[model samples]
Target: MLQIYNTLSRSKQGFKPIEPGKVKMYVCGMTVYDFCHIGHARVMIVFDMVVRWLRTSGYEVLYVRNITDIDDKIINRAIENGEPISVLTNRFIDAMHADSDELGLMHPDQEPRATDYISQMQGMIGTLIENELAYQANDGDVNFAVRLLPRYGQLSDKTLDELNAGERVAVADGKRDPLDFVLWKSAKPEKPAGTLWSSPWGKGRPGWHIECSAMSCDILGEHFDIHGGGADLQFPHHENEIAQSEGALYGKDRKDDDAPFVNYWMHNGHIRVNEEKMSKSLGNFFLIRDVLKSFDPEVLRFFMLKAHYRSPINYSDAQLEEARAGLVRLYTALAQPAPKVLETALDPNNPWAQRFAGAMNDDFNTPEAIAVLFDLASEVNRAQGDEKQLLANLLRSLAATLNFLQREPTEFLQAGAKDQAGLTAELIEERIAARVAAKQAKDFAQADLMRKALLEQGIVLEDKPGGLTEWRRA
Candidate 1:
């Protein structure tokens, strides 16, 4: 009984896949012209969380996240770099994968590149034109006839006139209406060969909006369970996707088989910095690799998931430190040794697990679900022996559903912050040995001094029975 906030309907609806126990989801993925920014991190992590939860709920999921390898931005970036479009895009695509791997994102089931699906895009455009839902302009650009589709602005919840009024730019020379968008753009003479594809409408490339429509339809069919992207795409991008996909398949006909393009539309909120919107012009844009230089990748992922996916999250060093501290506490509990734990799947009988499920079922409310994790951590800390092991096992199991707490607790706890170079492992161990010797020799002052010195360097020392000492970065 999972409920998803369907953006198309503007309400949370019970999720029922077109095929029972199977979900076909398509997310608009990165346009690999440049390094991925923090904004891209949110999209990658948020949808990844969704996919993880669906599988944990026992639903088989086929997640398709399309990459826009060919676009206006890609073409321009290649020109700026004085390289072939393939080289420019391939470089960034690899960089994107590296970043995704750092963030621990699962590879999508089908990562269809816009460039590879040129024929599929052309076929959809051809159908749109034949159905009178699109037109070939005088300039040879085939544009979707937004006026022909009555539900043009349904996803955005605006009428055509209202949408047209909000437009800042006047109609272009070849467009029939100001609201009309290109499905196929006529190739420019100066554009590189890599950017152009031969189509029925002459040599050109797929429009940005049409890329998702064709890729999703070709991979997941016309009507799928879920379609998602960032909230900024809700207006022109996703709305155009609806128009293109539905118009091509159903056309402007009567009420015959009124199946929508997608059953659910999900959009995650934006990432802001210091309470202001993140943008390059404002100098707040951060590259994922650059941020990873200072903070651990897990810390970044934790920071991204700390806030509810639909709620805007403000980014700052202070915010990241908070996320790091919270993760540390959980890992600290997990680092403790315990007896064998037998639990595997989430236990319905466990109160904590039930609460976790309820939170996840309610529109994937991660904030509430994460709160349950902290509660489980508390129980794990308070319990003893086998009870402690069971609770700890449950905590890890539940966290796995959210893709948290998968790494070795020691690995995560000892990794320390990338920016911190205060105490090396060798130095920490040497100090621990010195402190142990000092304690053994009854030199109380020297032992206290060794402990204080290590503490000063952000290392916390915990003395155990049988004269064993353990340390972790603070």
Candidate 2:
């Protein structure tokens, strides 16, 4: 059985789906105003690992990661770029897919866009109005009444008084309370044309927080098995979701008859650089595309899994280079050919597999699970015949659960270096041939010089038995 740390409970608990053998998970996805940064990468990769593990654990998972295609950021970006909102969003959406493909992320089962559910959002807002949980302010904006709902700060574990004192909360003119958040924003005269919708509150758009509440409940029902996002969202965004969703479901009386909005809440920690949070405003943020220019996508993925999901991971060239070196070792062990064997299920009874499963079960502890892979790799290197083949298969199968080590070892090793350097395969082969000739002629100094030149170009040569030599990227 898998145990996950529930952010709401602040402790690890056994995972039990509301429906046996089934899970409905909703994760807040990208805003799509620009290219995804490393922070966004963490969210996508973390949840992708979770979904993969659930399916591997024999549960049917309905994964929905919603896209915020109609947010204020999207609108502003479209205006700045002088493109239609759809045009801007569609471009970034394609870019997001390219990035995701490069990173080897499994697409979510359902990717609900915010614009597609406008009617549902309006309906939910009306329910809040009818129950007096929300009200139309003098400025024609609809706001959720935080004071009206008892236990408003349950998720953040902060009282109304403390939240009021927090400097982050803005006191707008029309809002009754400073802590109250907008459910619907009235259209401004300068707002984009398509951005506004005719709602009961007037011509306006759904607020950022309300979009998720409506979309998640509309797609996954009023209550679901799990809700996940980055830890940054736990305070205002997710806390607001809980308030609005549960308020609409149970009404002002706040009865507990029906199911809770979400059974478990999970949050992945942030990515840091030099012990500071990685943010574009701080000049420390790296775009996924920018990072991929230098490091392989698999290397970035491995770097993230090297740390526990809930722990902060630092981003640096040194860290990525280290991860690249580690991947090379894993692939090197897989370079040797193994005896052919019939396909079979991953043996849960196998000790190594069991150990891997145990680490994964204990809150998706990927670092420890990766250690198990290294152990299997050691065994694969030492064993021969069927034993070696079995260990290699086990290594591949377990690593695949975390979406790693799927490429052919030699191909992965040899492919990328040439791209990094201004060299071609033909050039590398010619150099290798020259080095071989020099060695055969016993020109030891010439052969050594040739090797040094190739090494400087990021190509490494390995001499094997029977006068055979192989080369790969450094």
> Against the true structure, what is each candidate's TM-score?
0.96, 0.96
Tens-place lDDT per residue, model 2, 1-474, is 899999888899999998999999999999998999999999999999999999989899999999999988889888998999999989999999999999999999999999999999899989998889998888888999998887778778888777762566666668888888889999899998799999877899999999999999998999899999999999899999998998998877876565778989999999999999988889999999999988899998999998899999988988998888878878877777632333324578889889999999999999999999888888889989777877787788788888888888887788653266777777889999999999999998999999999899888899999988888888
Q: Which window of 10 residues has the lowest lDDT sum in candidate 2?
A: 337-346
The true-versus-predicted C-alpha distance at residue 159 of model 2, in Å, is 2.0
lDDT at 146, model 2: 91
Q: Candidate 2: where are CA atoms >4 Å away?
A: 165-167, 256-258, 338-345, 416-418
Give one digit per residue, the lDDT tens place, for model 1 in 1-474.
899999998999999999999999999999989999999999999999999899988999999998889877888888988999889988998999999998888999989888888888898999888999898889888888888888788898999888962454336668888889888889889888877878887998888988899889998988899999999899899999999988888888725468888999999998898888898789899999999998999899889888989999999999998999999999887877632333347878888989999999999998899899998899888888888987888888888888888778877777778636666788789989988898889998999998988788778899988989888778
The global Cα lDDT (0 to 1) of model 1 is: 0.88
Task: Report, for every candidate in turn, its global Cα lDDT versus the true structure.
Answer: 0.88, 0.88
Question: Which pairs clash (backbone N, Cα, C closer than 3 Å) in model 2?
Answer: none
Supply the TM-score for candidate 2: 0.96
Give candidate 1 regions above 4 Å deviation. 165-170, 254-257, 338-344, 419-421
